[model samples]
Target chain A: MIDNTLNRRQFLKSSVGVAAVAVAPGILLYGMANGSSEGASAKVRWGMLIDTSHCAEGCNDCVTACNKENGLSGGVAATDSQWIRKIEIKEIAGGRQLSLPMMCQHCENPPCVDVCPTTASFKRADGIVLVDKHRCIGCRYCMMACPYKARSFVHEALHDQNPDVPRGKGTVESCTMCVHRVDQGLQPACADACANKAILFGNLNDPDSEIAKKIRTVASVQVRADLRLNPGVRYQGL
Target chain B: MYIHSAVLFRNRLFYALVALAGIVVLAGLYSVHLMEEHGHIITGMNNQIVWGIPHVFAIFLIVAASGVLNVSSIGSVFNKHAYKARAPLAGLLSIAMLGGGLTVLMLDLGRPDRLLVAATNFNPTSVFAWNIVLYSGMFGAVAVYLWTMMEGRMKPWSKPAGFFVFIWRFILTTGTGVIFSFLVARQAYGTAILPPMFIVISFAWGLAVFHIVQSAIYAWTNKVLDDYVQKRMKNLLGVFVIAALYFVVAYHLTNLYFARQSDFERFILSDGGIYPMLLWAGYVLIGNVLPLALIYLPGFGKSYHVNLASVLIILGGFSLLYVFIIGGQAFPLSIFPGFEVKSTFGDGAISLYYPSAPEILLGLGGVAVAFLITAVGIRMLDFVPHEDTKKFH
Candidate 1:
């Protein structure tokens, strides 16, 4: 009897009220449970600080960890996929030898993102550069544009890929800064695996973070800083 | 009855040539299929040497395609009667070479099937994206230009169409050169000179291609190119070759002056194994100098020498591109300016690339596609040059 003569306006208003009440709590809870559901936030800028002084010359734990985390083949052939590698460098005049892990520096002004014709190479708001493989045509222009040579083209068909880290042949790929782990409020595989604690991962924007505090006090440098790409990755004791 | 039989025999030969080209194209397609199935792992291209022999072939054709239009531009835009007569043939060659060049480039991609994605998704900032627009726009412009030239009613529009193409080719060639120039990281390519250098190089290469094709057509039809026309075209080719050589020299000298780029210059000019050889012996002596001599040197300007020069010029074009595209990449990036770096990824070391069978086949297929198009187009259309005898005399 209460709604026996209800008008269209009254009926619509009641339906809206009921639906909002029903859905609001679930939406709020979901947002609370998965903060990244709204996508990467600009408030956070993820970065890495590598202290080469602490790094051992022969240690390849970081590379191994990255390979496992990313489901890479761990092959070092010119055609094989190498997401990360251990580079040994000697100063021409100083003769100082240093070993460091090299991968995508995740530049704020990434050349790969710039040269990518399809916008397949992009940067997340949190400063992680990633390849949207769904849109990638595998032209490798991004690879040529990359100064670090950090990117690799998938030369062959991949099998048993990590479900979390999706990859395939005919797409360019590089370090995602362990984006999956970083999104879940976890350390990158390389940082977590470093035995000597040489790799430090944190939010560069958060002045309170350890990496921010350390970088403020230490003399760290970005590779190819002259190019003015302003990469998030920094090295100490180079 | 004898004349009828001769015409019938000529028709048969044409069909046979078309069939041979078709077979080669099929083989090329099969190679592409295999490459797609196996991925780029089967090709000689790797992480270090990202572009290879296929790129050399593709770039040469694309550049020459733009250059071939110069003939039509001179005729229709400049209102030269001799060139106007030959405009249709030039137009045909431009379309043919462009088709061939783009085919090789598309097939060499890691995901040629995703051509749709490339067409739809464009990053406005990328020079490569701009090139996509430029390349497609070229085909459209050239097609309309050709239509205006061939159709009797559209004849009045030919001048305007030719004018548009003249401007468009310059922009198009600039786009091609900018593809390399925008790579700020590469030692071999970041300079502004590359665009102009490419434009001039295209002039020489394009005219050389036109000469070869024109000669072949003349021979087939039993028509001799008028002596005056031959002399004029050969002189133009000589001038272009010299101009191209000047640009090349200027580019090298500029690179040699930069302290950072000096090592790269030394590597290309003297040190790098095959690169230096290709530059000096192949490009300089054969592609540029020898062709110049054939055109300019007394008694060397005969039909035989001119034709031989054209062939050598084409060969030299391949050699130069090989050094430019592959050799450019062979030199390692200077990631750390003052460091000697070593990595499993071939950092600080010269990357090795050996062109595989499938790669060569795929490249040759592009050439066949171009050849097939030209043969059929000439047979179907009035593309053969008909010089105005009264004006020439």
Candidate 2:
């Protein structure tokens, strides 16, 4: 008798090892697919460079596009959700006029994130500041702390929300930098809508990206740079 | 031997007061329901002016609540015999007022139902997070402090409890001031002096509240508060009110000196419509100056005049908060320096705010809740002291 017990134990160990080896590759591939968006790495910091000089005085293409894309064209006047808006600024001394779209700067050191009690206002690994609506108590302390005044409180009940951009009543919201498009490897709506090539969007950290190349060639200014928030959004010819 | 104090539940006056408070609280609850159902659009607050009258009331109650405990702290911690008798009432008022303030703050949330989120998921860096812990901690500390004072066997524990409370209240008020002080965005609030300033104002406001309640209790029980006790407390209040004014002046002067902050200073001191009037006439003249003169003046040392000063101080407290909370927001954020900017959003313009009825009701409801708690507490326990001149001396 050739020790039947020994033979059975060896058979069981060999079978278990073979099963794991066969199944492991499939599980690893699934995990990789879920983790990477078409192999887009999080090492790339997304940013925007706007040439205000190229921007037209009255053209609201970017604003309208953002509204349409974000489902904010509703009649919530005085309490309207304005994710991005064109601001007209004139120098008091020189009578020089400048127009630029203002939105969340997507700061590396966001004061809104700092003041939020529930950590509802948070920055993603990729540097996009977002409000977690489920967690926000809507105390508006973040609004007070934000130097740019980029955030808005949802003042009324919202219906007919865009399936792509989810929003609701009793929560604070602001520009998500069209994060859905970004995840899918596409430009933001505002950048896509710019007829005069005023808005440029791309990966800031990538040395070969168009935005980084342009920023290297020309001077760009971040609004309220004195605060040293290290804004992802930069303006040319302000 | 100790003389046991009697509870005051049988008075018809007590019943009437409790009933009135109950109605106010109900009204406040109804308003919260309406705001929750219809949304914040029903209120005067817009996106620009986020915090409104509710904040003014809430902050005042919170600061005053901390200050109210000073009497007990002085008695128990510092060994002042005169204040020992008053310690129990002081502890009661502090807890009640703090509860009232927290209630308003909770009801004002966009999703009051999600209070669990705030309690559980906290940002350690945020002053508000610290406040939640401080405020919740305060209730437990103050309740035990009150217990230590009330029970004969627990008398030995009172001093340590009072010491803990004194230190805690200081930190609590400091955190409250830090909520604004830490804001780098606001030109009006960036200062190290804010915490100390809040402490002084808390003292004045808290003492004023204590005086009003004390007088009412004495009147109700057909007893007299010793003249020496009245004189000492009122005189101390006068000093605190003046110190508060001095801090206000120093704060403004500091702002006025900075070129970047000059416009904001101007807006608050002179040009801004309601702010200037409230700051000068309401807070400085009526609240501080007139009261200071009354307390220090010879003939005005009587209980009637002292009470009048106390009432004015309380009113002045409202004015000061109105200026601090609303006025701070009214002056627009300096988004772009040296540039005149205009947008669909109210930029380069002072955002308008008018307090609505629902907001007022909610604030009053907080006050009513505080008063109701105090009334119930005194009715059930020996919170009020049996003050005899001989015993105190």
Candidate 3:
């Protein structure tokens, strides 16, 4: 009797696992086909160039813009969901003090992507680190693995979600490079909102592009360059 | 038969509690929905302290749960027949811990709906991904072991599986340590203490959880937890507490001795105020010192005080984990050329955060689920023992 029960349990477990695999993909494909291809316009390898020289000390337009576009929360409280941040980097003693506009570095080798127990957080073929919200199990291992603290966890129920970049509680979120808007050939809300042009959006791979030219003609460094994530985003002295 | 049915009817209390937890979880699911739709606004977490109470609690519970299983596996694998009787319980507890821990994680997320994304598209590079695999394997083993035992299928092959679980548990704990260890930008870099720290946490949590559950069950059954068992567990906890304290002292001393930057870091233990409070109040007082006193004292030993100490130590160990993850994250390294740059996540700068009601309720639901699973297994299986009590015990 016990053996029969054990066999039945095993059979049940296997069948459930199999049935899940069989049915899940059909639903996922249907969803992704509806969503992942939302941007049918020119596919751009979105990158950032934070010009520390002109940042208005604490004008959080870029932060708020990303939040507004991506549907994030902002406040005086140190927010867990920082799609962007402005950090003051002083030059040692008496030189220039610069404020950095920090966002996801979107590394070529994102540590967060590296340590995920599941492939929920993955780098798209186009070098974008995207979380397949459908597959994310809320483990937050990616949050820990992310050196930049770039990821944020939704700790509570937030239903008034933005349609463009929809996110829910219990999953990790970061600057998506506006996967939604960028699909339509639109620039990120942060770059679009930066009146000072303190932020630049372009393709890092495009040598003919202004960002690539700036990197070539002048010198810029990525944050924590020593960590060797090869961050796509670059900063001009902060 | 009706009397037996009456006993089963009495279990309705447990069922009612489970149902109550389910309702709370359903309410919490609304909070998850809110977080999913709007963003993480229902809680106090901000950019400064993104990983808050739920993360710490989940991680701590998992390590403790892993340790509970380790105690049983260690004995079984190594021919320590003395511990063999406790193997089933340990196996059961491990599954419970994993379930409880994962549920905490699920609720803590900004998007619990996408949790499956982690598994379907596994990232080999992500430590979190590796943790998923490790947890899957660990839980899979324990669950299988438990199921087999319940079905009276325990065989020679079980020992090898137990041995595998025993070895990998240390690795899993060490890997958990490495998660904190690899943060070079953070002041916790170079402590080389994370692995041992988890080991201590695992022991404290495991023993505490063990005693807590056992004593509770024994209480319900109107049976006294044997004096010998209580004495042994208390002594074991006392020894671990001292060792954990020693590691804390040695770790801090070594840090301060090596790097002056750590002086500012030591503020966590000293000047950081609440961190120190958590240390002295949480880790030292509840986690180590009080438990030590309780174990040594004779009066408390006669009653459920040992069980009570277990609960306290479990809470204390949880607090220490908080100090480690949250407090550790809070202390910014004084790496700026001249002065200490405060951590975005630290005290004063710490964005006030706690587990949202939904988060806690979801955690409770996870516990209920685990208990319900265990109850069902116990009802249908010989692992709960059929007739002969002394044979397995």
Q: TM-score of every model?
A: 0.94, 0.92, 0.75
Question: What is the fnat of model 2 with respect to the true interface contacts?
Answer: 0.80
Which regions of candidate 2 fall more than 4 Å away from where they truly are? Answer: A1-42, A74-76, B1-10, B391-393
Best by TM-score: 1
Q: Please give, for residues B101-159, the per-residue lDDT of candidate 2 as tens digits.
A: 99999899888899999988999989999999999999999999999989999999999
Candidates sorted by DockQ, descending order?
Answer: 1, 2, 3
Scored by lDDT, model 2 comes in at 0.86
Error of 1 at B349 (Å): 0.6
Off by over 4 Å in 1: A1-34, B1-5
Per-residue lDDT of model 1, residues B139-177, tens digit only: 999999999988999999999999999999999999999
Interface RMSD of each: 0.7, 1.0, 4.2
lDDT of 3: 0.65
CAPRI docking class of candidate 1:
medium
Ranking by TM-score: 1, 2, 3
Interface RMSD in angstroms for candidate 3? 4.2
DockQ of each: 0.66, 0.58, 0.25
Candidate 1 lDDT at B123 equals 97
True contacts kept of each: 0.86, 0.80, 0.52
Task: Point out the higher-scoring one by lDDT: 2 or 3.
Answer: 2
**A67-127, model 3: which lDDT tens digit per residue?**
7787666743454466776666556577566676766788888877766666667776556
Report the lDDT tens digits of candidate 2 across residue range A1-238. 2453344234334432323322443332112212243333345467899999998888889999999989986343667778888888998989899999999999989999998999999988777899999999999999899888888888889889989899988889999998877654457899999999999987676555588889999999999999999999999998
